[model samples]
Target chain A: MPKPERIDPTDARLLLALTEHPRATTVALAEQSGLSRNTVQARLASLDGGAKLRSFERRVDPTALGYPLTAFVTTQVTQRRLDQVAEALAAVPEVLQVHGLSGETDLLVHVVATDADDLYRVAGQILGIPGVERTNTALVMRQLVDYRLTPLLRRAAEQ
Target chain B: MPKPERIDPTDARLLLALTEHPRATTVALAEQSGLSRNTVQARLASLDGGAKLRSFERRVDPTALGYPLTAFVTTQVTQRRLDQVAEALAAVPEVLQVHGLSGETDLLVHVVATDADDLYRVAGQILGIPGVERTNTALVMRQLVDYRLTPLLRRAAEQ
Candidate 1:
């Protein structure tokens, strides 16, 4: 397997600038990061080329799209059919993320729904998947802290 | 309390266009979505004003930052000090997302670490929070599906 790409200090600083101002133009990034416009442009190209800077869809909010309820479903899947189970789960738009875990729970699925009734349907769909054995769902009552990456970027830049 | 801003079908089309081509320029979005450049620009402005289009930072991967290990930590906090516990947890850089759930668990913390040893340290710090009572953590062995919103956007656009 190929080695993972490493981000250097300057690249980290650029990422930090982007984290703070995602819509900043190359000139703006140059001004904010105290780097030349050419450097900012080149670094951005490198990051995008290496697939470090992911697509813009990551920034879209499910709540804004009318699916506000988020839930975590931990499921036990038949070991032999893990791949099939993942494929089936991926086909469900409500299932936002799926992780294979290290314990009794074989899969941890993060799902969102427009409401409780919709959540029930999504969960049922997951349970209906051939390889999914059992599932336990926990609804998110509130979001205390939204997902973030600034702290890590700041630390990397500092280092 | 202010009502949450609602996105119209036209706005949904623009968002779908952006999801398909995250790095697309406003001109590109206009052409792809079959909207005028002025309309695309205005819709973009409204989405930004409503705070519906989140910052691009969410696209950055912690694993790419060398924190390859990911874990979910469920904590039971002292009811009276729930806010205080949240504040403390927010102070930890490795804690990426925290959600207040509707069941026995009070908070579900999504965290990333440099490795298993680092994850241990991060979890220990979380457990050491003043109002934190009990904790259960599950390490992510593999990511079967990444976070995504394209399918939902496609559905919304089509509708």
Candidate 2:
């Protein structure tokens, strides 16, 4: 295990800049955070070691790509095979997101299929994973707006 | 407005392959799809004209980067400011996934914040948006997995 490196306010600020535009150059990030360029690089290196950094890559709309079926499936698992089930679910291509959620369900899965028929087949595959007892699935009717990370990064900077 | 371009099964197969590995060269894709490289490049040209190929980009993870606060905010809108509320809320940087939901709430927003306090600040900002009636939020504790196109594309290819 790596030692926990402390993150100062300036390092956090620099991270905010990069989160918004992962493509932001070292010089641009330094200017944005009012830090020296080398300082920004060193801080980024520290960030890499301490906390994971998710980069800014273009996120596409599934519907736009002809995947009209989307569902949020929540599952409850039997204790014994939690990790195995979760790992197996992760390997499935349609299940975009899997999580150990807190509410009524222990696991939450976000999935995409070409149509209702395909969704059923994919859901069956998920259900087959060991330890999965029950699943509640909600179909996405239509997408209003999708993903944009700009606001998230901005709020963190303000903090 | 972009008119829809027709995509045959072969075209769909090629597109799905590209979505799976955007960096895959046409030659490699040809080997995977069992099609000539020239056929693949021509399909790319037609899709570009129709705006079917939005972009090819690397997908980045946000949590790995330190902005770990992720939430889904469902908001109800006053009749007068439905459009304005949606637009304003969309303007916020933290709210990455915004949806005009149907049932109890008018919209559902996915936000990524730096931490717990940061998520609160983002929620507050959403509450401040004009015509915003009220908001309920579900924070994402873990992102087990995320955006990938291969699975969906594979189904399209089969069709």
Candidate 3:
């Protein structure tokens, strides 16, 4: 894991501005955050290159690519072949993410499918993977709150 | 829900190319995808306007903002006050996502915290929310397979 970088109020304020205006130029960000253009430029450079930013792939909604249905699969795998299991899961196109967790379940697998049949097929495929012992599928009925960081950004700015 | 737009092999190929080179210009995209500049421009405009893409905020890592610990809270809520529960969850900055799911749990809350104590506090806050019956949290130990779509895109292109 990369070292956690502390975000100061100024950085948070600038990030909040950028969230509101994703395509904003350095000058605009500076104006919005009440900082100099150079500071904004430097901060942005650091942010872009650092672990601060994740892949742009997150911006691409799977629904657009035809996989609309979303589900979480709690997977239990053999301890010895955990790495191999992860590799196999990655080979499955429907599996979007797999996070090892603490508790009854070993891994939380985020998946998307085109339909019920597709979802069933994907689940079965996951089950068939070597070292994968047990699996539990939970279909997402509605997204109560879409993934967001604006509120956190606001809090950071205040701090 | 908006109508699901069908994506052809050409569109998939273009999107795959864009994923690899997010900073690629329309002309560059055209060259890579073997399509005309005008076609690439038109497609990009449509993609930007359509439901194909999500918010740019997804590119920002919560870890970078000081909340490194990730957990999923399976919340059981009173059915009638689902909307209110969702509203309250949205108000909490740490609650990054809440998905209403089928099965025993009604909502799956994705959250991030600064540390164990922070996580406990956030979890307690969620449980304290009115209409929330019970809450179960599974802390993310490791991200085995980070969220991805390149394989899915490759499959789409093949189709």
Q: Considering every candidate listed, which one attains the maximal DockQ?
A: 1
Instruction: State residue A111's C-alpha deviation in candidate 1, in Å.
Output: 0.7
Candidate 1 lDDT at A4 equals 73
| Residue pairs with clashing backbones, model 1 | none
Q: Candidate 1's fnat? A: 0.83
Q: What number of backbone clashes does candidate 3 have, counting pairs of residues 3 or more apart or in separate chains? A: 0
lDDT per residue for candidate 3 within A55-89, as digits (tens), equals 76787788888898999999998888999999999
TM-score of 3: 0.90
lDDT of 1 at A146: 81
lDDT (10s digit) by residue, model 1, range A46-153: 887785766777788888888989899989999988999999999999999999999744899999999999999999999999988999899999878888878888
- Off-target runs (Cα >4 Å) in candidate 1 are none
Candidate 2 lDDT, tens digit per residue, A1-159? Answer: 663343445755775665455446678989988999899878877665454332211333455566667787768888677778878887898887776654534776888887889999988998888778988676665455555544444444565
Instruction: List DockQ, one per candidate, in order.
Output: 0.76, 0.26, 0.72
Q: lDDT per residue, candidate 3, B33-115, as tens digits?
A: 99999998888777777777788778788887889899999999998899999999998989999999996348999999999
Index of the highest-lDDT prediction = 3
TM-scores of the candidates are: 0.95, 0.64, 0.90
